[model samples]
Every structure is written in C-alpha cells, then in structure tokens.
Target: MIWHHLFQPFIEFGFMRRALVVCLALSVSTTALGVFLLLRRMSLMGDALSHAILPGVAVGYLLSGMSLLAMTLGGFIAGIAVALTAGLVSRRTPLREDASFAGFYLGSLALGVTLVSLRGSSVDLLHLLFGSILAVDNDAALFVCGVASLTLLSLALCYRGLVSEAFDSAFLEVNARRLPSLLHGLFLALLVLNLVASFQVLGTLMAVGVMMLPAVAARCWVRTLPGLLLLAALGGALSAWLGLSLSWSAGLPAGPAIVLTASLLFFISVLCGTRSRLADGLRAFFN
Candidate 1:
C-alpha cells in the first residue's frame, strides 16, 4: 500500500506526471547550455540571470492571470535585459564581465523582491522564490517542451557559428562573412530560454546552481565536449529523479532538494574523478 501510494502519485496525479516530464526536458537543455557556459567562463552569469528574472516574473504575474506563461516571458525578458546591461557596462567601464553581472543581478534581484512584496501575498512570493513541483500543470509542461525544442534546434542549427565565436571571436570576425555579434546574441537568447524553463523546477536562485554544478562535475571526468555534455545531462536527470523522490518522502521543497542533489554530485565528482585536480594532488601526495 505504501509503495502503491508513493508510485501512484506519478500515475494518478496529472501534475506529478507533468512535473516529471518538464523536469526531464529541462535537464537536457540546461545540461547542454551548462557545458558551453562553463567553457566560456560565464557560469556565474547563469545564477545572475536566474535572479534577474524575478522582476519580470512579478510583472508577468501582475499583467496576466496565467502564472506559467507570464513568468516564462517575464523571466526571459529580464534575463536578456540584465545580460545586455551587463555587457554595456563592461564595454563602457573597466569592470570585468563577472563583476558587472554580479552588480546588475544583485540589484535586479532586490528590485524584483521589493516589487513582489508590494503586489503579491507572502505565499505567492515564497512560491516564486522556492517553487512547487506539485503545482505544475499541463500548460507548464507544454511550455517546457516548447522551450526545450527551440533550444535544441537553435543549438544544432548554429553549432558551427557558435563554436567559432566561442573559440575565437576575432578569428571568426576576420574569416567569416557572418557577424560574430549575431551568434553571440543567439547564444544569449538560448541561455535565457534555458534559464526560464529551469526556473519552474529550480526556482530563480537554485536554477543556476543546478545548471552549473553538474556541468562542472562532469568536466572533472570528461575531456571532450560531447562527453561532457552527456555526463552533465546524466547528472542533471539523476539529480531531478532523486530530488523529487526525496522531496516526496521527506515533505521538503523540491527545487532546493534537486539543487542540493546536484551539488552533492559535484562534490563527489571533485573528490573521486580520475581527471580531477584533486585526484592529481592526492595521487602526488600518496606517491
């Protein structure tokens, strides 16, 4: 009976099924994006973008009664806006990209929270910040699937351009007729979409953590780009499954639990990975 009840939730409850499906879809997209973000040394920007979406989400909630669509659009817009602002600041000032991102995201986060407090109930604010998988519905599931499809397609179509720009913008600019700036914009858009879809499962704060930690962990073991992406997806999906199970069993928050699971996996990878820096240090010490 206990097993039946535990498993029955997935079968009988539509929301639970939707949540699982959406989480799986997002895991794949975010994992791929994470690989590129890590390579570009822009991992922290993922966290910043996630937080920057808060005001957009709040505004969406206020404008339309539909939480899912509103939040998705709002978050996407907010993420792009913050990224653009950070880029402008970095270009005009002497500040580094990371520093600019940090400043902008923190300010955006504070603004979002203040706006949410002014317009929404305490419970609504908590839900936006923490998230609840049990609240996922059919529309949210469809939205997640749509975003995932677009991200995958965009990446595949622009793979050559993206790789060129990422490796050497100057080289691409000199060699290719296409503008590197266009490719860069596309990458940023993909990042925003990835972040928006992930927000449902990881919330704003934890989404970046989930996206980056697994990729970082996977990099410890894999040298090739494809291998890294595959490992990161495996890590992300495993975390999602384990985190959902733990949340159900312990009556804890799912988003935080999922992020925690990813973090733990990262720690393990750091400790035991054959290619890890720590592994080399330990090997030298032992020898």
Candidate 2:
C-alpha cells in the first residue's frame, strides 16, 4: 500500500530511486551545515571550499581510477588545507578572511581544471562539473548517510558551543576559554563532510548555492536559529523534490535544475518574506 507512489519510480527505473535518495541526503546534510555557516557570516566559504576541492578530486580520479571514497577523501583534505591556510593568512597578514578564501579557492579551481584537462576527457570534466545523481550507487549512498548521521550527531553535541561562538564569540572567548575555537573547528569539519556528500549530486559549483541560498532565504523570514534551520531544510528538501520531478519530466540535467529551483525559491522568499526589503517597504507605504 505504502509503496504504490514511490514504487512506480523506484521499481520502474533504478536511476529514479538513486536520484531521489541522493538528492534527499544532499538536502538534509547541506542545509544542516548551512545554518551554522549563515550565522558565522561565512556563507561564501561554502562556494570557496566547493571550488577548492576540485583539484583534489581530479587528483583522486587520476590516482585511484574514480573511486568515490578516494575522491571524497581527496576533496576533504583539500578543503581542510584551504581552510587552515586561509586562517593562517588572515591571522598573519593584512588580508581579510574573505579575500584569503577567494584567493585560495579560485587558485585551486584553476589548478584543478588544468589538471583535469591534461589527463581527463571532455566527458570526465563535464561529469566533475555537473555530476550525475542517477549514477549514485549503494556505496555512495551509504557513505552519504554515514556522513549525514555523523554531522547531525556532532552538531547536536556541540550545539551550545556552536551557538555561543556564532552569536557571541567574545563571550565564549572570555567565559568558555577554548570552546569558541573548538566550535569553529567542528563547523569546518561539518562543512567538509557536507561538501563530500553533496559533490556527487550537486557537483562543486551548484553545491554551495544549494547549501547557502535556501538558508539565506529562510533567514529573511525566521528570527530564531532553530526555526531558520528547519525552514532552510524544508526549502532545500522542497527544491530537491521539485527539481527531480521537473528534470525527470523535461529530460533536463538534475543538478542545475535543482539549483535553479532553489534560486527561484530564494527570490520568492526575498519578495514575500516578512523581513524582506520588499515586504518591509510595502508595509511602510501602506501604514
């Protein structure tokens, strides 16, 4: 009885089930990380890190013959390396955090492209850029689930420290001693995991947008952190579902379609949300 709706897609075509599962996992995990990123005002880091991991993935493919675990590990290492480098540069030099991130990630992306061009075919490059949700296998799905569970658990355990650091870093610094830095490290680790899990579904380019845009849109409407997280997750999940359906019906690319749906929702939220500039202006004019 319960299988009737899902069975048509799952039983009729293996790709459909794979697509749905991959997108669902991506939505949940990415949105969860987006919450903390948004609060820290480090939202753009998602884009930077996504791009920064490209070279690592290319290297992984070259060395390991396209193993998902190897690629994910490579990407994870690259992301952490970039993060640590950015932190050091920001602390030691006059460069700001954003500038440092932009420099490192853009460089990483260019390097990745160059390396891929040297060894990989055009199709391989395209796959790395756009990704194939329907191609997700059991191993990839299990890996995503495992990462998501770990991310959720870590975030739950570090909630107090994370919230304090995000909202009031100085307070944590004065009272909790090492708590702020600890939370910061945890957030970075979660971001890396989310990127790894999402790379297969959204690719490096679209993953950041999917992770951040929904959270930004949700933020304009919700005041509380928990509410913002829940709304962002809902927005992400809805976008994933809509995007999958549309792509299936129209025979379009799933990754771009999903990102486009999320972008549209963001614009809608900007127009209709309570804290939106348009809404505020309208209210003032009416009043």
Top lDDT: which candidate number? Answer: 2
**Best TM-score goes to which candidate?**
2
Backbone clashes in model 2, listed as residue pairs: none
* Runs in model 2 lying further than 4 Å from the true structure: 1-11, 277-287
> Model 1 reaches what TM-score against the true structure?
0.92
Q: Tally clashing residue pairs in candidate 1.
A: 0
Worst 10 contiguous positions by lDDT, candidate 1: 1-10
> How many residue pairs clash per model?
0, 0
lDDT (tens digit, per residue) of candidate 2 on 1-287: 43543245566887787777777776777887888888888889999999989988999988886789889988899889999899999999999999999999989999988888988898888888888777888888888878878887888888888888888899889997887777787788789878877887678888887899889889889998889988998898888877876776677888898898999999989988878878778789999
192 Cα displacement, candidate 2 (Å): 1.2
- Stretches of candidate 1 off by over 4 Å are 1-12, 277-287
lDDT of 1 by residue, 151-205 (tens): 8898889887777777788998998657787888888898888888777766777
